[model samples]
Target: MGLYHFAKSLVYGLLKPVYRMEVIGTENFPKDGGVLLCSNHIDNLDPPMVGITAPRTIHFMAKEELFEVPVLGKILPNINAFPVKRGMSDREALRKGLKVLKEGNVLGLFPEGTRSKSGELGKGMAGAGFFALRSDAYVVPCAIIGPYKAFTKLKVVYGQPIDMGPIRERKASAEETTELIMAEIGKLIEVHR
Candidate 1:
């Protein structure tokens, strides 16, 4: 196993029982090629929860602040996570995300940009759509619910890959494309709930 997979499995083995985690529709994940795992943000747990359960290694873009921590700084990149500046158009970060996709690796993105304080889905940022458009990669909508506390059931639902052909052909606005992605994510959340 790769370092990323090994780390995910080890962490997952420990946390699975604590959260009573269940992963649904993992079959929906494409077996190959570049794809985007667009999901809603809830807390710091969301990334690891989805990453460990995903069938493939997922490269994520975490907030730059998290990388400032001494230990996390060294660990996050080792696990395929890179830093991105939140609330701004960080070109370098976007370039990195595109590079991952171009290399035919899975890229995980929390379309909402940051964790939801209310634990409810928030509006998506344009990054997911932008990457999908530029890379011509399939977009998979994933929903992670519950897991708000210890002993609670944490469910992750992987929805079917969203076809962005029409949107890409028409050259849709980033806002419009993001709404569609968020809509798909919302549907997955409702299904898992």
Candidate 2:
């Protein structure tokens, strides 16, 4: 926990002023315990934006390519970030997410996997929902409303936490649960456009 905060302070101090961030619904973030945060992907800055906004460490499932890089790899893992293969099942990534929750760290996921080229949120892959179910982590739907214009003021609106117990307990198919997860995220982000 000490290492987590140390890294967060270092990174966030440098980036927050540079981005000139504006975060909304910060009150929606939990102060203690583990959580699964699901958000739309837009900018590469998205993860750190979410990190500085939260009072806790938010570990993202990063791309394997990031690890191959020299500096980001070292800094990212220290901040609790791990890599996932681009197109495969990526069970190792999922297992790491499960471990994150087990160890009481906040896990961040972008259902779309990669950033959208169209400047819009694409159909979510639903793997995020399955992980939430498996870990029994409370899903917090988030919307990153426009750093489409980068140095400008951006809005990150987070909504109330979604209860996953009923669907998870029902042992529903991955498809059904994914729909619910996406639908809930859509609702929270409805006004972003």
All models: lDDT? 0.90, 0.78
Residue-by-residue lDDT tens digits, candidate 1, 1-193? 7778788889899787789888898999999999899998898888889888899899999999999999989999999999999999999999999999999999999999988998889999999888988886779999999846888888889999998999999999888898999999999888778
TM-score of each: 0.96, 0.88
Query: In terms of TM-score, which candidate is strongest?
Result: 1
List, residue by residue over 34-117, the lDDT tens digit for candidate 2: 788888888887887777777567888888999989887787787788999977888888888889887777899888888987
Candidate 1: where is the Cα deviation over 4 Å? none
Whole-model alpha-carbon lDDT for candidate 2:
0.78
Clashing pairs in 1: none
Lowest summed lDDT over 10 consecutive residues: which window, candidate 1? Answer: 146-155
